[model samples]
Structure formats: structure tokens, C-alpha cells
Target: MQVIRNGFLSLLALGALTLEGHAQAVVAALECDFPAASTDDWNMAASTLQYYIDTARGWRVDEDSFSFDGTANIVVDGKDHVASLSITVSRQSGRANKTLRSEGRSLTVSGECRKMEASGRKF
Candidate 1:
């Protein structure tokens, strides 16, 4: 009887440890910065830009022209009265490339994942 009781206690302890490990898996915000635009037409659009990738939830940003989830490759094709920007995130590898055009001038930027943090609760 004592041996059976000890075995049950061991199983319960193992379950608790597993739960604790799973709780630590979480997603944090992601940010990327691009080069300065050569022309003033894209100044306003490039100033207030932010991007985030949540491993569980998906990708999010403040711009309306950009829409992406965490799973597939990201693509951004946006155009306004004064400027336009196109971006693509590679699926086969972890890399991103972007191009911004305004007033007959263009700027390009490339990005890669530096580090990912797990701060928030898991979904």
C-alpha cells in the first residue's frame, strides 16, 4: 500500500512540472526599422510605423495596407497619394526585404530575426 501511494505522488509531481514548463511558453512584440526615405512624400508614412509577430496569435502592425499572420510569409503592398511601399517576408527562410518609393526616389531595407522574447502569457 505504501509503494502505491508513493507512485501516485510521483505522478502528481510530474504533472505539475509539465504544466509549469508549458506556462513559460509565450510571445512578445517584434519591431523592425527601415532606412530613411529620400523624398519628403514618404516622410509621414514612414514615421509612424510598427510591426509585431506573435507566434500564437499572428502578425500585427499600425498600417492598414499591411496584413499578415504568424504562419505564412508576410507581404505588404501599400500605396498612398504621395508614396508607396512594398515588403516581403521569406517563407523558406527568416528574412525580410522592403522597398519604399516616393517622388521618383526609392529606399530599400532588409531585416532578420535577432532575438525573440517570451514575456506574455501563452494563448
Candidate 2:
């Protein structure tokens, strides 16, 4: 059986990701301890609702059955400090691995992600 599959149930697989029971691609924020760059962060744009990071732009989130199904496989462009970031969150352990290829820097980050409050930060 494939663990969590879509909807709020999928959030159950990602311990760091949690919403108010309404999980249909909601705007959320990600804060991780990136040793390569502490300022590096991530968030799901409220407007595009697309996942992106602070390293640089040009990120295309691929659509697939695994998407929003416990594991998020994001494909990135061949440029920028954060070349690629793929997160496989499990209900037991939630962590983000970051690598800045330019400097050969790498680190593992862990933090909580919650539903972002609309309005002030809303796009």
C-alpha cells in the first residue's frame, strides 16, 4: 500500500506540514536551518500556489501521482545556489536537505510548516 495519498491525509505523512483539515494545495511556509545560507527559506505562493525557495527563481514543480502524495519531487533549473530540493516527508521524521553546489556546501534542515495566514502575506 502506498502510504498517504493526497488531501489532508497526505499532511499526515509530512509531520512538518499541517493545515486546518483543509489541504487542497494551501499556502504554506517552510523554515529550515540552511547552513549554506541561513536566510534561505521556502513557501508556497498564495497566488500561484507553487512551491519555491529563496536561493533563486526558475523552479518548475513537476506534476505527478506522487505529488501531494506524501512526497514532493520538485525539478529545478541548472542555475542557482539551490540547484534542486526534493523533500520526502514522513509522519515520523520531517527534514530538508540542502546543497549549494557552487561552494560544495550541504546541510540538513528541520523545521515546522504551518498554513500561512491569508491577507498581509497574501498575494
Candidate 3:
């Protein structure tokens, strides 16, 4: 009887621990998109975004690609520093030649992200 009772109590404890693990909140990656006015316009915008992510402390820029549309993944650590920034840009041209004047390029960036550490406690 004693052995059976002990085994049952142990099982219950294990179940409680599993439930607690599932209850913990996890930080998820945030995604964002920046649309360019023209295919040529993306070069400047993407460059600016990369610069911001690289310069920020503790922040990381994971990957970058450009075509016609642009997308980026930015990661910030618990210290509000950037952990990673992955970007994709796409563009398509058939017949017309595209020319981008250097002087016309303008970029502006502002903002900050805070990071939260994951608790070891389950759920």
C-alpha cells in the first residue's frame, strides 16, 4: 500500500511540473516589412536599416536580401540591444533600365527595443 501511494504521489508531482513548464511565456521573434517606392529605392532603404541594426548595441542583424520587396527580422536582447536583423528585398525588371541618383537617397531611422530574459522555471 505504501509503495503504491508513493508512486501515485510521484506521478502527480511530475504532472504538475509538466503543466508548469507549459505555462511559462516565451519571447517570440517579431517581423516587419518596409516597402520601397521603386525597385531602385530599396538599395538606400535597406542600407539604412542595416546600418541602424549594426550600430545598435547588443543588437544582431542575422541576414539580408533584396529584390523588389523588403522584409527584416530584428532581435533584441534583454539589455534592449539588437540580437539579430534578417532582411529580404526583391525587385523585378523586364525591359526598362533603372537609374538611381545617389544624391536623391535619403534614410532616417529611430526607435529602440527592449529584451526580456527567459525564466528557467517551467511555464
Each candidate's root-mean-square deviation in Å?
Answer: 18.8, 14.6, 21.8
Predicted candidate 1 versus true structure: per-residue lDDT over 17-122, tens digit per residue = 2355564333333334433333433332232123334333334433222225222121224432343545554433435565655457665556543223355322
Q: What does the lDDT read for residue 71 in candidate 1?
A: 22
TM-score of each: 0.33, 0.25, 0.17
- Name the candidate that leads on TM-score: 1
Quote the positional error of residue 39 for candidate 1 in Å.
Answer: 11
Flag the better candidate by TM-score, 2 or 3: 2
Computed on alpha carbons, the lDDT of every model, listed in order, comes to 0.36, 0.27, 0.23
lDDT accuracy of residue 20 in candidate 3: 50
Top-lDDT candidate index: 1
For all candidates, the clash counts are 0, 0, 20
What are the per-residue Cα lDDT tens digits for candidate 2 across 31-107? 22222223244322111121222111222233210113122332224332323333422223323332222233332
Query: Candidate 2: TM-score?
Result: 0.25
lDDT ranking, high to low: 1, 2, 3
lDDT of candidate 3 vs native? 0.23
lDDT of 1: 0.36
